[model samples]
Target: MDIFTGLINGFDIALSGTNILFCFLGAVIGTAIGVLPGLGPAATIALLLPITYIIGSPVTAVIMMAGIFYGAMYGGSTTSILLNLPGEAASVVTCIDGYQMAKKGRAGAALGIAAIGSFVAGTVAVLGLTFFAPPLAEFALDFGPPEYFALTTLGLLLAVALSGGSIVKGLIVLVSGLLFAMVGLDPISGKIRFTFGSIGLQGGFDFVTMAMGVFGLGEILYNLESAMKTEIVTTKLGKVFPTLKDWSDSKWPIIRGSVIGFFIGIIPGGGAVISSLASYAIERKYSRHPEEFGNGAIQGVAGPESANNAASSSSFIPLLTLGIPGNAAIAMIFAALMIQGITPGPFLVAEHPDVFWGVIASMYIGNVMLLILNLPMVGLWVQMLRVPYGILAPVIVLFTTVGVYSTQNQVFDVYSMLFFAALGYGMRKLDFDPAPLPLAFVLGPLLERSLRQSLLISGGDLTIFVTRPISGTLIAVLVLLIVGQTVFFLKGRARA
Candidate 1:
């Protein structure tokens, strides 16, 4: 079907009472969670995964999940403006100018412009997703085992390169995750690989449990080591609307940010944080008064806020079109679809049109809901910051435990979650990133299967990956990424 017809059908599904209600709920819940520092969209989605099962339809569940992803992004700027706290990692840059604006009694304007900018960027991203994703999916229909293997290889490499850490560390974590994923059984032979005489190991590790442990409980544990405090700006929030001058100054930055964020988000490991940082740097460089950046510049807030939200929305493209999630949050969303027995891939648009279009349509509705909700309910979001971490941490732990136990009424699942939680905590202490591990774990099976299948197709000839046009191009890209990262890593070390 054409884009227009597909969107029309999607609206038909998204406009239903159930889908709309869940979308709104997701947005509200996501915004609330985002107001709490360190609880990013990925952790929020992981914490809420079990609840998706109760939502009934796969499309409905996904509509809600998608709402949570981008909705958190919309609300993340709140704490940044009010308390100079980044509720989401992507909101970190917003703190520089947003908090300064708040101190100068321009908090309301900073937040209002952020909401407006986010809405505009989100709309742009949705339009891109509507038109761009389907054609990309159609193109992916040509992929075979060799192509898939090469693509996944490139994806894994890109994940490491963009991890914002040492490439060697990212690879270490990724390989560890692959080993973890090898437990249970070999896919082709159906022979148990590492069960070690335990029935609980028979099903392999549950993605939901692992995700909740690492992102939900582990994050809370990591944060507990640091003192959590909030000194909220109590200045009477001025008019909750940007002045004409604010809009005039911010218009171009928002547009530029939207375009930049959309493309960056399509790359593996590229998401809100990176997009926001890049947008801020770009805006600062282009600004007539570059020196005004860290003070009360409205462009600083508008640009990064818009970019992060735009990136969040466009990050869905790779997952829907290529069955590849670019980051941890998208990976969890992929897991959510798998829980519903709906696989995401190039054929997803053709096979599960309702899910694809329903999610896209819900984004339009969710953005409107966020804009309306954020401006009017800024006070409520601020109140969320007042809840003590002492009270919040245990509640998060309890909820994670309950969710894991409810999965199959099995104690083993809970134990596995606790195990990963401890492991996740240790990894954090060692300055290692836990993001790539779960993502690698999730992608390991697909990578292995593709590798095995490609070998069989080529009669054990490993050259098949570099022989095909698409596959060869992908492998070449992977090699370039490795070389580039190695050179960069060496240069930094030499300078150090």
Candidate 2:
């Protein structure tokens, strides 16, 4: 289909009553959760995953779900600028200069830059997705079992590498995720592998329960260790829009961040968090007034905020094109798609253009909605900070428990949730990131399935992964990643 024709059809579908309404609701709910610190997009989406199941249309459900993620990117800057609190991990870099701007009584301008930058960057990313996704999907149509196994292997490794922490620690958790995914019956043999003589175990872990426990409940539990306090920005937000000077200073940063984020977002594991951090570093490097960074530089706020939002938008590209979700939130959306019996991959654009293009079209509308929602209504979101985490935490706990139990009336599912919630809490305290775990869990079975198919095709020959052209390239890339990591690690040890 012609790109223009596809987009027009997409806009037509996106403008329909139901899609528009759900899109708006998703934006509103997403921003609300984002303004309320400690309930980031991933956890919020996990908590709300069941609701999407209740909705009939997969496109509408995804439109809403997608809105929550990028909307959170915009909303996260609210607390970062006003309270010096990062509502999402991706917003952490914004705090360095955003809060400093608030102290300087430029809170409103700081926020204006973030919102405007986010909107521009988001639009750029969607444009990138519009042009890039269809062709990538076309290219991916040729993938066979060998290519798929190799790709999954690379994806799992990239997810671990960019997850930001000790590589060894990430590997350990990654392996654990794969093991946990092996709980049910063997996919090909039809024999149970790890079920401990229990029917529930035979069915394996519930995705919704495990996700709710680890991300939703676990995050709430971890936040209970400290008191929630809002540091009020005393200065009046005199001008909510950036001046011409602020605009001039931020235009280049916004452009650079958009490009940086759109591409980085395509790589597995390099989502909003990494994009924002990378943008900040690049902005600092390019700044003529380097000292101004971390000291109220508008570029600092503009660049990272743009990058994070852009990353959030473009992260959809992989899922929509290659069937690889780049982050936790997108992974949840992937699960949602699976539940709806819609598998996103090379065939998505060709087979389900409505789901593919309607979503792209909705983002254009969603970004406009968010800009309108965030820019003028800054004061409304500020009010969200008043509700303390002490109250919010328990509310989330209660909400997730009910949501999980409703999925399966079994008390064991709730118990399973509680168990993972505790596991999430301990992992948090121990500096082991729980984000990669859920994603790994989701990918594990697919990886195993692909590996099995590839081996079968090659008559159990192990070199098939390196023998096929596309698979060989992917394997070569993985080899480079491993060698690169080893060299980097050795250099770090030597420097120490």
Candidate 3:
């Protein structure tokens, strides 16, 4: 299992006709949604997960899905530049200088630099994945159930802190999700907990249906309540290639952003949005001409775009190596692997080498496809905005409903999905973040299993969680996060 040999085998699978085709399809679909405002990659992936089972192989399904993740990162800049609209949270910073450049008739150049920077960052991230994932997984081989419980507990806490709302509210949502996960039969004991005498509840809630409901249908429903209007900035066609001056100005920012983003993405709750923001802030701090940032600085566009893409790629590390997804997109990926009957963890690289490596290799190919798609196809993506939301929302709902129903071929699953959709919409209207809920649901069973196993191994001693080195360190980190968040919450309330 040398890195080179692993990569070659990965490329062997990735370069296959079927994988390449799916990869290309994913890139195209990811870019399409990225250009269309309001439908982020997480929702798109959740919406698509049901169809993944039909793809026949886990490797191809995951490769296509991974392509969508990073491809959206590459394509999100298109709308940011042309319409001053961010397709996802990570692209928000791009709207600053990117829209300014568009106004100054440098839209094509801005888009070009973004594509180049994304490609470079994404390639670097893939290389990092190749080298870093195996060792991390190997290190994790020594972990026991106590360590797992600690890690998952820490992950849940991090999700609440980063979920972007009242910490109390996030906790409530997290708890609700955990309760929802309790609907099925107990993992350890065969007896059911909360089914309440429903036959469909016996099998528990379908994760795919719930995901589609909460993320896909719920998002669409929430967006429909808002009055969204787009005014596209149409300018004269210009050269799609960046000039030497543009390259000189952007080269260092791209590299710095990539490095910053990769490390940030490794942390729990760290993601493309935060990484891009950090990159923009750092680039501004170090820039010789700091005042040019909000105006039309290429660094503003280059840094954040590169950082977000890099973060998106490296964020896969936690999921692949540790079985913990850092954010909702990666959570969807985790769910996909679970649906494929493949658990991602320390042994993932050893047990499912094809999946682990094929995904990495597909990223390299996907980045190239994105670069090739971004330039000549920019106009095509721009036209996508012209589609009215009035017509679009129903289509999305119809697809989500069909996808959910297709999972069990039962009307009850569809009803369950709509129920969660309503719940998600209600939460959104109340300013409660639903992001943590699905993630919490996905991790709840594993967390419970780990806790039970740890307790049994320790013979009912609670001290085992804090007694082990790895588990102790994780618990310490979790305590610190809770204390910090409590202080922050109190301070905010005092100020308010």
Candidate 4:
């Protein structure tokens, strides 16, 4: 089969000594970060983004970062099971039952199921990427500015729709993210909007800084406030492998999660998080003992863990094929690609088959590595929780400081990170979701660029957006989603 040959070529690239070493290093470091509380893959990648500059080739840099992405997804579940703390957003559902399982002396089985499910999901998702990416890229080539604009709009609407709780709040956060993205230079006129005369402000706030602030520092601050009274679950080393019953119960959830995650991941914005949450919700809704949820259900750990990893893999499709990043981690990869003078788009598959297929192959290798590393080393990961907070806190702060500064070797980034940290902490206190902010910021520039280009091509005619069938259909779906949310909200209020 042609697909088989391409996979062989991919393996040839991934198995090379140089790539293998980097892949292993990425997995090791990613797992380390995943075991630690308060740090997520986005922050870890942001911290390492500067390393790509020294590493040279964008292909290698991206491959390594991709390792970190999936590796962390694999590692985060360890923390969720052992400590009741999720190292990343996607692992939150894992904590619902993973920690409880630990308390009930099934930590090993919970962790094993997570590892196995992630492996299956990740492998299938990469295969999907390998066979489907080129054709998707070809299709995207037919898109015009209007289509892109419509697509971005649809992405934003989807993000809002999936935001859960208070659609108004979700929209507000989404708009705020869009506004934050507008702080930099105007692409059309080369004029600044929100810089306000500060030289540092002219370049705009880095999304990395904002993400670290919101997810990392804010998490630390919240935990610190309650650290004194928090109960830590202790795990008993039981069977390190899943039982026949565990396998039977989890097989369907793993399959369902992978399918759901892959499709959601291709949808442009907040797909990974949404897929994970949706998978967990689905698993719970369909489980025979729904009441056992949040009290050590193995399906909870298996389903969301599978979804998160699958979603991480599928998120790459948009980035590699269309130059559109589906999430923050993918956006950072885009920046690395641009830094290497490599353009990602329709021609990427033909222009750089090695980079394209090689990365895909590396994922397969990385997934296997993660499964091996996560299972046998469960005890080592659990030991990480025993590390003293006083010692760990400073290390995290140091990494955050260095990573932000490394972005452009500017101390201002450090201050910007601190400022956002405070802002993030406040937002958390107010129950304001920060998810939409990064999504909006990343998509804002592209949205503006496409809108202007579409208008230019249409001589100021707005009908250009509706003329394209795909674009029109996407717009209609967005409108329907907004109306549906509104109706649901009004109905709920009326009942109350």
Which lDDT tens digits does candidate 3 get at residues 312-361?
A: 99999999999998888888989889999999999999999999999999
lDDT, each prediction: 0.90, 0.90, 0.89, 0.81
**Model 3 TM-score on a 0 to 1 scale:** 0.97
TM-score of each: 0.98, 0.98, 0.97, 0.90
Q: Name the candidate, 1 or 4, with the larger TM-score value.
A: 1
For residues 1-496, write the lDDT of model 2, one tens digit per residue: 8889999999999999999999999899888877878888888889988887689799999999999999999999988888888888899999999999989889999999999999999999999999999999999999998888888789878988899898998888789878888888888898997878988878888778888988998888888888767765455665889999999999999999999999999998999999999999999998899999989999999999999988999999989999988888998888888878899899999888999999999999999999999999989988878777777777788888888878877888899899889988888999998778877888888888998998888899999989889999999999999999999999999999
Query: Candidate 2: misplaced stretches above 4 Å?
Result: none
Q: Which ten residues in a row have the lowest lDDT in candidate 3?
A: 228-237
lDDT for 182 (candidate 3) = 81
| Per-residue C-alpha lDDT of model 4 across residues 111-189, encoded as one tens digit per residue | 9999999999999899889888978888988888898898878877676677565677778888888888888778789
Per-residue accuracy of model 1 over 1-496 as CA lDDT, tens digit each: 8889999999999999999999999899878877788788888899999997887699998888898999888889998888888888889999999999999999999999999999999999999999999999999999999999898878877887887887778999899888888889888999997888999998799899889988888888898899887665475678889899998999998998899899988998888889999999999998999999999999999999999999999999999999998889999999999999988999999999999998999999999999998998898888878788888899899999999999899889999999988988888889888888778888999999999999999999999999899999999998888888879878988999
Of 2 and 3, which scores higher on TM-score? Answer: 2
In candidate 3, stretches whose alpha carbon ends up further than 4 angstroms from where it belongs are 227-229, 494-496
| C-alpha RMSD (angstroms) for model 2 | 1.2
lDDT of 4: 0.81
The TM-score obtained by model 2 is: 0.98
